[model samples]
Target: MTSMTMLEAINATLRDEMARDDRVLLLGQDVAQLGGVFRATEGLLERFGPDRVVDMPLAEAVIVGAAIGLAAAGLVPVAEMQFLGFSHQAFHQIGAQLARMRYRSQGRFPMPVVLRAPFGGGVRTPELHSEALEAQFVQSPGLQVVMPATAADAKGLLQTAIRQPDPVLFCEPLRGYRLVRDEVPDGDAPVPFGTARVAREGDDVTIIAWSAAVHVARRAADRLAEENISAAVLDLRTLVPLDEAGILDAVAATGRAVVVHEAPFTGGFGAEVVATISDGAFYSLEAPVARVCPPDTPYPAGKIEDYYLPSVERVVAAARATVKAP
Candidate 1:
């Protein structure tokens, strides 16, 4: 057991993976010399050398396109996009080429590439630095989108993403990089994908969320407990290969649910959660599925970010409304 921040856990995981596998390498703008914008790749360059920790130009398209070639050639390339909003520049390569490589090659090619990016509001970053555009990646057929809410999950999920045969979009919560910390296990055993963790147990309502929103849901659950409204918090760690069973189980146990995320309400991943519950757990539902999210507007600047991001107050209110619905 080790007490470490999410940033430390990610840096350690990258180091461990690179040391364990010779073919594992990193490429991103300022990842080598500048040690990444978040310092997630701090000591990797010194330890792995320039060949393995190659610094890339400021072109997301060229970076992702080159990674596809590297993966097809046998090396496991972990490309960092600095910010999830910037991933749009490589949408063609990511959604078109890298995602369909295995299918296009008829299983002849393995797209073992990991695209890492830090996202979500509350970090007060510049424009295009804190957008929660995960729903876009979830629509990509061959891509897997993962968002870790804690230090331990961050390490475990990164290990799993690096070793996966298909392409993975690893979304790290910028707010949690330093705010969240926990005891991470001391092994290389990768946490499997498509699994959800129950952050809290209850019977009145289920609060489902991913990434930084998990923290808000947990806090909301705690507040609801004071009012004798038992609320369960479900952390959907990975979105692409969503944990259907886990989500259904949680919703069935509570009979009510509120989906939360930092993204916009319309076309957000929360809608998928609501739709899944409607399809599979509809009979068990006591109330309509509620969603706690921001409006479908552009991510606002830092000054008014609090008004744009989902808060614990909003989550608590939604949970209360779901429980009171009859």
Candidate 2:
């Protein structure tokens, strides 16, 4: 096993995947010369040449459209959107053509395309660079949404996303790119989708989260442990193919749940989790399923980001409320 950050693991995975399969190519703005904004694709151009490691124009739509064409033909293309907020510019191509290609083709095209983007607050990005709009992509049918919180999960999940037959929207947390670290296994085996890992084992309450929120949930669980409140952290690695059974099982054991996410509270992915718990483990719940998320307002600036985004304090408070609720 090699100890690495999420960004290093991603870069290694991309390099390995490209070397393992010649058809796997990469395309995005500044990917070739600049080696990507975050340098995730650094040194790839020199190794694979410009043909495989391409540098596209500053157009998210064209990047995705070209990837769709490549997938339809034969090659597996992993396209990057620089920042997730820029994906809105290519929503039509992604939702209309790329996602529905396999179903629309009637067993012809597998749509083996992976659309990657970096998002989530922290590190203080400018406008349109830090929005956690994962729920929006989850609503778009025919797309497998994946958000990896740790360095190991990031490597395994991205490997899985590239090898899979369906189109995947892989969301990487901006903060976690360099901040989160883990000992990643050497093998390139794909981590199965729709399977949630237990970040921490506890019987008092279940804290469900993905991507960056997983760390927050872990910190909150640690804080709750100080008060003798055991909180289990369930990391839902992938959102689209959600692990309903795992979620229900965790909540059933704990009898309480607190869902955490960075998106707004009104319609974030947390709502769907709460709904799942309500429908499957309603009787098992000792108190209402609580949620800790951002407000309905837009992504706050960096100055007030600590106050706006879901913090460990907020998650701890929500868990305490649920555990103490009558």
Tens-place lDDT digits, model 2, residues 128-190: 899998999987788999999989999999999999889999999999989999999998757
After TM-score superposition, what is the CA distance of residue 263 in candidate 2 from its true location, in Å? Answer: 0.7
Which whole-number lDDT from 0 to 100 does residue 223 have in model 1?
95
Off by over 4 Å in 1: none
lDDT of 2 at 205: 93
lDDT per residue (tens digit) for residues 193-309 in model 1:
999999999989999999999999999999999999999999999998999999999999989999999999899999999899999999999999999899989999999999999
What candidate 2 gets wrong by more than 4 Å, as runs, is none
Task: Supply every candidate's count of residue pairs whose N, Cα or C atoms clash at under 3 angstroms.
Answer: 0, 0
Instruction: Please state the error at residue 40 of candidate 1 in Å.
Output: 0.3
lDDT at 37, model 2: 94
